[model samples]
Target: MIYRNKTEAYWEPLLTIARDELGIHSFDPMGKPSADIRMCRVEDIGRALERAYDLGLMVGHTVTRAGCVNGECA
Candidate 1:
């Protein structure tokens, strides 16, 4: 599923990778995991999420004018 919302768009890929590649079925975003996913770095995921947020902001600006850009101007 293609998620357009910022949170899901950012996390869904990482969650999928955690489940498929790492064989982790008990992953929960709200709770701590019992085991870490192999070869995954917290810093890397954070950077990716930031990038996703930026991309989503750009797309949202291009599609609609619902909110002020960067809270600078309405």
Candidate 2:
């Protein structure tokens, strides 16, 4: 189940709960929120990918300060 912590951004607080509480692995801090929430699951890698999509994470490309890599951003 998803939950919250001290963070106030879109998905920032969940990171701490996922790692410190649920013990799930977190992604690298790219496309990081202003805060630090992260999502977790017992076995839901697809769900995590969906969450990233929901949060406007463009996919299938390398992202950088310039823009989406090769017209994609995942």
Candidate 3:
């Protein structure tokens, strides 16, 4: 999810990432109340993070073990 910020300069790069990298063909602001956050699916989260990092954006993900559930370990 792209968090909304006051920097309008980031908008173009964000859109480019969403379209070219994230495979989002189109954007519809009317479909939602706010256009702040944009959520999309990418084939690989690691690749997405790399792309975002290259664009000077910081993206992070957390991994848990298979036996872990809701922060608890079996």
Candidate 4:
């Protein structure tokens, strides 16, 4: 149950911790990014960690493409 609001922080860190600490597997892409987090489910911690890490890296790439270099998306 991942409810998102346009007034919060990214959930990637927390979700990653959940996988490592609680062994709860979940990830999804059902939110307005930069203001929302996704959720999904898996059966194992390893899988969850893998998927979440992959997603994190992917998102990083997305940010890099249109990233601000000199205070603008240069």
Candidate 5:
């Protein structure tokens, strides 16, 4: 599925949390697993989740916004 927000403003912060906070990096599927795809420990997931919550990205049980910036909410 296509992402609603493809801008760097939307993705950069999320990527920072994923790469800097969590051990898992390199979303590239074709890259080497050893260096590119690091396995995430349980603690890593917890830390990322906490960071996401603090950033107001994920609240309660919802995530997707009500409307899209391009007026293509569906």
Candidate 6:
């Protein structure tokens, strides 16, 4: 429910997907892949986005971005 900033709230879900589904533990801006990583399918992206929406984590959402405790982003 608490995020460091708007960016964090937005990126949390994607990062979770990267970690949980891809087994990616860390990242580097200019780093190259060191192993053969499994790619996420369209379905995976859809589900993660949906989960973020259901949790009200998107921009304009009151759950995290706007700091509203009782309203949803519409």
> Which prediction has the highest TM-score against the true structure?
5
Which residue pairs does candidate 1 place in steric collision?
none
Ranking by lDDT: 5, 4, 3, 6, 1, 2
Strongest candidate by lDDT: 5
Candidate 2 vs. true structure, TM-score = 0.26
Model 2 residue 4 CA deviation in Å: 22
Q: Which scores better on TM-score, 1 or 2?
A: 1
Measured with C-alpha atoms, the lDDT of residue 24 in candidate 4 is 47
**Model 5 quality (TM-score):** 0.51
Q: Of models 1 and 5, which has the larger TM-score?
A: 5
lDDT by residue (tens digit), candidate 4, 1-74: 44565244457665667767555455544466743343445555556566668777887887776576545563
**Candidate 2 structure quality by residue, lDDT tens digits, 39-72:** 5564565554555565544332324533764555
For residues 1-74, could you state the per-residue lDDT of candidate 1 as single tens digits?
A: 23355475436655554455445453444343433334656766566566656767877786565445446455
TM-score of each: 0.37, 0.26, 0.39, 0.38, 0.51, 0.40
Full ranking by TM-score: 5, 6, 3, 4, 1, 2
Candidate lDDT values, in order: 0.54, 0.49, 0.56, 0.59, 0.63, 0.56
Give the per-residue lDDT digits (tens) of candidate 3, residues 1-74. Answer: 33456357656665676667766544544456665355665565456666767666332222244336465555
Runs of candidate 2 with Cα error greater than 4 angstroms are 1-43, 57-74
Candidate 5 C-alpha lDDT tens digits along 1-74: 23455475547666778887785444445545556545678888889878877776454223445345456567
Candidate 3 clashes: the total is 0
- Ten-residue stretch with the least lDDT total in model 1: 28-37
Model 6 Cα displacement at 7 (Å)?
8.0
10 residues in a row with least lDDT, candidate 2: 57-66
